[model samples]
Target chain A: MIALYRVLVLVGLIGLWWLISLQVGGVIIPSPPATLGAAQMLLAEGRLLPALGDSLITFLGGYGLAIIVAIPFGLLMGAFAPVGKTLEVYVFALAATPRVAFVPLIIVFLGLGVEAKIFIVFLGAIMPILINTYAGVLATDRDLLEMAQSVRAGRVETFRRIVLPGAVPFIIAGLRLGATIGLINTVVAELYTAVRGLGGLLALYGNTFRMAEYFVIVLMLACIGVLVAEGLRLAEKRLVRWKSGS
Target chain B: MTEPAAHVVLSGVSKHFGHRDGTPMAALTGVDLTIATGEFVAILGPSGCGKTTLLRLLDGLLQPDTGSICVGGAPPRPGPETGLVFQSFRLIPWANVRDNIDFALTSSGLSLSERAEKVDEAIALVGLQRFASAYPGELSGGMKQRVALARALASEPQLLLMDEPFASLDAQSRELMQTELMALWARRRPTVVFVTHSVEEAILLADRVVLMAPRPGRVIESLPVDLPRPRWGYDVHGHPSFIALRRHLSERLRELVLTDPGSDFFQRGAPRS
Candidate 1:
């Protein structure tokens, strides 16, 4: 019964969409089928896949760089009061600003190339991950830390045994959120550049007034973001399974 | 990394905690104690009685304001001579029980193979051999405490400090753990300072139970329990001698607690048996 209800709900949405498009004319409303067909035609032209592939490379590289830098800094900030105080307010302020606002500025500085796009993606993705990871490390149990000290555990071993394990779930949460944002930022980065990612395609489709094809690319990018986020969540679940067992 | 020598001395040790807003809050007064190698001493007191502070002083986690603390022929060295078991178990959430035990042994001068062997031995000693791979979160309350014990014991510390390790467990589990601790202590006699409010646990386990009084914690009574091992844990329960010792210790603890029940920390909690 629940499955039937789910089917009916989904059908109702699609039926409404189709009704609106057919009644108002596909030229104006652009039915889902027309968008899908346009997407297929764009793929047949053999451009979408490579463009997406290039976009992902930039997305991942930028995201990876941000994470690598953010992780150690975040950990340092959390563990040390002076460092956190010095960096936290400024970091949050920077993160709070929308990355889209920086595109024109970034383009002027780095030019309309992969570097600029990657920089934009990095700007978008780093702060939340950095902030949340800091919070995670900061919230680690002081008792457990004292336990490490009571044993006279060397500083390195203390980090390995206690600090890293304690901060993992939080780090994973930050990373999952960052991955989706990184993808979105990648598209936003490409929206102005000559780079052939989905964002660039959206721009090209827009110039030609082909909004249906643009809509298809947007859906595809949204799917990628969801898949990436879901993957991280699964990994977090597996990692924390041991914690729950005890 | 000093040699794992064996000495723990608290000479005229005292500690004070300020208020939440940083006014003076004395936690310990001038107190002197010496725990020799292989001595099992229990610091029995009601809550906020500076028993934990004394233990921490011995462990070098806190400094005594008025006195000096020395461990292993010198002042507390940054190495593995003092292994502590907290009430909360405080196990690393990611590591399994085996890793938790092995953590204390990491800085010890044991080879990898030796560490592995000792980890297994400790698990067996605590009767947690079957759950070696299990994480702390998976274990029952009793089992978590046992794992805590195993972790402390695996390092083969000359001094072991426990802050009411069994206070959280049920009657059956606590008794079972008491028996397990005795058997293990008999075999690997580390000098132990176990802090607890339970007069029964102190009497049942300590070579000497140091009864502490409440506000600005001070040692009031030091009663000896020289019950020889292989002491049967079940038979020891309500034994005439154990009961007599429990009564003596409880009377002292009650007096200390009632002196200033105004502290509000020890108001609503476990009664000393």
Candidate 2:
């Protein structure tokens, strides 16, 4: 039933877009069919798939790197009081600052290439993952820790069995947030650095007044966002099933 | 009757915590006690009497600021030899009943099959065989505590330290758990030190009740309960001895509570009359 409503909503949105396009004309606004035709043209010309692949590479590289570095860093910060106290202010400050502001500086260091793009994505994604993981570790139940200690579980064992499992939901939440932000950063980086991914196509089409192709790029980005978000939701559900068992 | 050998001994034990303002606050002061092997001892006191602290000290979770504690003729340390149950059932919420019990045996150096056997035995002992795969969140408060108990018992600890294990349960569940605990104790006969604030609970289960006073928590008296074994089978509560001991302990407890300056009633300067 919900699926049927979702399809109806999609059709309604397309109809509204078609009506608006007729009013504005094709140069300013593309009809749904025009956007679909442009999507096919891009696919046949083999432009869209390659651009998408480039974006995927940049997104995965930076997002994956953030996961690797941020989780342990966060864990260390949370597990040790002095490290957490010293770095907490800086982490918060950096997180509060606009990530886009770092783009110029990142390009200066790494040049306008894949490295700069990856770094930009990494910078955008790392904060949420690190902060959320730190909070998760900090939020681990005291009673559970004492229980582990009472059983003479060594530090490693306690961390593995108790702290890590307790923090999983937060970590996944962080990952989900990181993923969305990472995708946004991927586009921002593509635009600012060497023109390469879907963002490049968007810039190219918009500048050339190719409204249908521009709409195709925009739709593709939205589709990617939806797919990624839905995937993470499913993963979160599977990982934290114990939480909802009752 | 010849007394069994002392399995646990604490001498001149003192533990203090730094208050938020950095002032030293004594949790347990100048505590001295001994428990015989295979004995069931209850440390009964009001809140803030450091009964939980004493249990932690015995479990080697916290070190005493001064003096010494010995369990099984060695300096106290938590291992497979010691099992502890908290007031809150501290079962890992993510781990099911069986896995939670299995965690206790992680450091036991037992192989997988051996650990599984021990876990199964504990589940059966606690009558939780059907809920072995159930998570803590799925279980009721009473069932959760049973899982906690089972986790502690899975290791077959020589010293079982329980800190108000059933205090969170409903009244009916509490009664049922008390009976089940008695049966388990009778069968395993581990050296047990159970902590609680309830005088009646102390009298019903413990072979000896060590009364503690707050405001620098220390032992005030040690009273022996001479009630017969299989206590649940008989109307132990209505027994003449049970009545006398309960009355005496309750009076002492009331006196202690009223006199303690930190107690709410005393702090409020409530009229005694």
Candidate 3:
């Protein structure tokens, strides 16, 4: 029933898009068929795959590095009161600052290349993952910790068995948030620095008033967003099976 | 039964906590108690009476501000020889029943096979063998408590400390758990110190009941339950001895409540300034 509703919604959205295209002309808003034709042309020309590959490289590089660095850093902040208290203010300050503000500095240091793009994506994605992981560790049940202490579990053992597992849900939530932001940053990095990926294609088509190809790029991004979100959701379900009970 | 050797001793033990303003609040003051090996003793008191505090002290989770404690001739410290069952169950929500029980045995210096065996035995002991693979979230309140019990038992602790283990359960489950606890006690014969606010529960499960009073919590009376073992096999509550003891204890408890400064009875009856 839900799937049927989703299909209906998609069709309704397409119909609306077509009606708007008819009224405004295809220059501003391309019809659905025109966008499809543009997608096919891009694929036939072999430009779409290479551009997608470049974007994937930038996205994965930045997001993967963020996960590796942020989780452990967050764990340390949470596990030790001194570390958490000392760094939390600075982290919050950095997170509050706009990612676009760092673009000039990042480009100056790294130049107009993939490295600059990766840095921008990392800056955009890191805070949510770090903050959520830290919160997760802090939110571990007091009773569970007491239970661990009662059993004479050592500090490392308790962390491994109880604290880390307890923090899984929070970490996954962070990952999901980070992923969406990271993808956005990927496009931003491409457009702002080296114009070599899907963001570059979007700039080219949009500037030339090729609305159909511009729509294709936008739809490709939407598809990628859907796929990443769905993948994370499945991973979360597997990791937190106990949360759903029987 | 022959007199068993003293397995636990607390002499002049006192514990204090600080209020938000930093004033020291007396949780347990000048408490002295002893328990014979393989004895089932219940500490009964109203809320704020520090029964739970005393149990924590015994479990080595907290240290007394004054005096000393001994368990099995050594200073009390949490180890394989000491098992604690919390009222909240405290079973790991991410772990299955078998793994939760296995967690308790991890620090026991047991090999993998031995720990697995102990876990299996504890699961069977609680009659939760069928649900060994189930997570705590999948279990009902009663089943969760059973998992907690099994976790405590898996370590084969010589001293078992339970803090209101079944107080959260429905009445029927509480009664059923009480019987099962007795059966487990008979089989393992651990020196058990159970804490609860319920008078009937104390009388039902314990061989001795230590009554405590609040406002600087301390033991006021220790009554021996002379009721025979396997007490559940008969109508223990309706027995003449049970009736007499219950009446005396209930009256004493009522008097404590009525006189307690923190109780609503005193709060409502007090003259306004």
Candidate 4:
């Protein structure tokens, strides 16, 4: 029944798009069928998939590195007040700053390459991961820590069993949020100057006013975002099944 | 049943907090207590009487500002020799019942096989055998507290410190746990220090109940419950001596709360400072 509603919604959206395209004419807006045909052409010509591959490489590198660095760093900051106090200002500043502003700076520093694209994505992704992990670590239940202390649990054991596991939910939440923003940054980074990826393709097709192709690429980006977010959600539910009393 | 041995001793034990500025807040002061081996003692008092603090001191989770506490002929320190059960039943949400109990035995240098056996035994002892793999979140309030008790017992500690372990349970579960605790104590006989606010609970469990006063908390009275062993919960509550003791203690507790200046919570019925 839910699937049927979703299919109906899709049909409704396509009908609306078709109506708009007819009224506006195909110059600025293309019909849903035109976009689908364009998507198939792009797929057959090996244009879309390779761009997707390129985008994914940068996204994974930046997002993965962010996760690796941010989680441990956040843990330290959250666990120790001295570290948190020292680095808190910088983390907040980066997190608050509009990351699109860094595109030009990244290009200047790293040049127009995969490195620049990855750096921008990292900047976009790192803060959410860091903040969430920090919050998670700090949110370790006081009673749990007291229990650990009373039991004479060693420092390593306490961290491994208590601290890390306690923070898993928060870390996963951060990763999901980071992956989404990281993907956005990847496209933005590519759009600026880098010669490959979906963002670069979007820019080329956009400049030439290939409305059907542009719409197709945008649809692909949206699909990728939803897929990645859904994947993380499923993994989180599996890993922390006890959280919901399952 | 056996000759009493000094398993725990606290002399002039004074603890203060918030001393960073100048005037420190004394949580406990001049507390002197001695617990014999295999004794079950409960420290009973109102809020701010430092009962929990006293229990923590016994567990070596906190140190006194002045004076000394010794457990098993040594200065108090956290180790496998002592186990603690918190009021909230702080089992790790991520760990199952068996694992939560096994946690207490982690540093005992026991082999995997031995540790597993101890874990299973503790679970069975708590009658949580069927829910060995259930997480704390999955268990009811009564069951969670049982897991906490099991975890504390798993290490086979010489001393067990509990801070109002059953205070959160419903009245029925509380009474059931009281009987179960009596049964468990009869079996293992660990030197136990339980802190609680309930008069009936203190009378029900402890061999001796130590009453504490607030405002620089100190031991005010110590009474021995010469109640017979195998004291059934429902019947014992109606016993003549039980009635006399309960009446006296309950009246004394009410008078203390009403008259004592430190008992700010009951100041409405008392002369104001």
Among these predicted structures, which one has the highest DockQ? 3
Show where candidate 4 strays beyond 4 Å. A1-5, B1-3, B19-22, B262-267, B270-273
Q: Over the stretch A102-121, how does candidate 4's per-residue lDDT look in tens digits? A: 77878889999888888888
TM-score leader = 3
- lDDT score for candidate 1 against the true structure: 0.82
Sorted on DockQ, best first, the list reads 3, 2, 4, 1
Candidate 2 Cα outliers beyond 4 Å, as residue runs: A1-5, A8-12, A15-27, A80-90, B267-273
TM-score of chain A as modeled in candidate 1: 0.86
lDDT of 2 by residue, B1-273 (tens): 997899999999999999999999999999999999999999999888999899989999889999999998888887889999988888898899999999999889999999999999999999999999999989999999999999999999999999998889999999999999999998999999999999999999999999999989999999999998889768999999899999999988888888898887563444668
| Model 2 C-alpha lDDT per residue in residues A127-231, reported as the tens digit of each score | 999999999999999988888877878888888889998898899999989999999999999999999999999899989999999999999999988998898
TM-score of each: 0.89, 0.92, 0.97, 0.94
Candidate 1 chain B has its poorest 10 consecutive residues by lDDT at B261-270
Over the true interface, candidate 3 deviates by an RMSD, in Å, of 1.2
lDDT of 4: 0.89
Q: State residue A63's C-alpha deviation in candidate 3, in Å.
A: 0.9
Which CAPRI quality tier does the interface of model 1 achieve?
A: medium
At residue A97, what lDDT does model 3 achieve? 97
B159: Cα error in model 4, Å? 1.0
* Candidate 3 local lDDT, residue A88: 96
Chain B TM-score against the true chain B, each candidate:
0.88, 0.97, 0.96, 0.94
Better by DockQ, candidate 4 or 2? 2
For model 1, report DockQ: 0.61
Q: Isolated chain A: TM-score per model? A: 0.86, 0.94, 0.96, 0.92
Give the per-residue lDDT digits (tens) of candidate 3, residues B62-180.
Answer: 99999999999988998778999999899999999998998888789989998899998999999998999998888999999999998998888899999999999999899899999
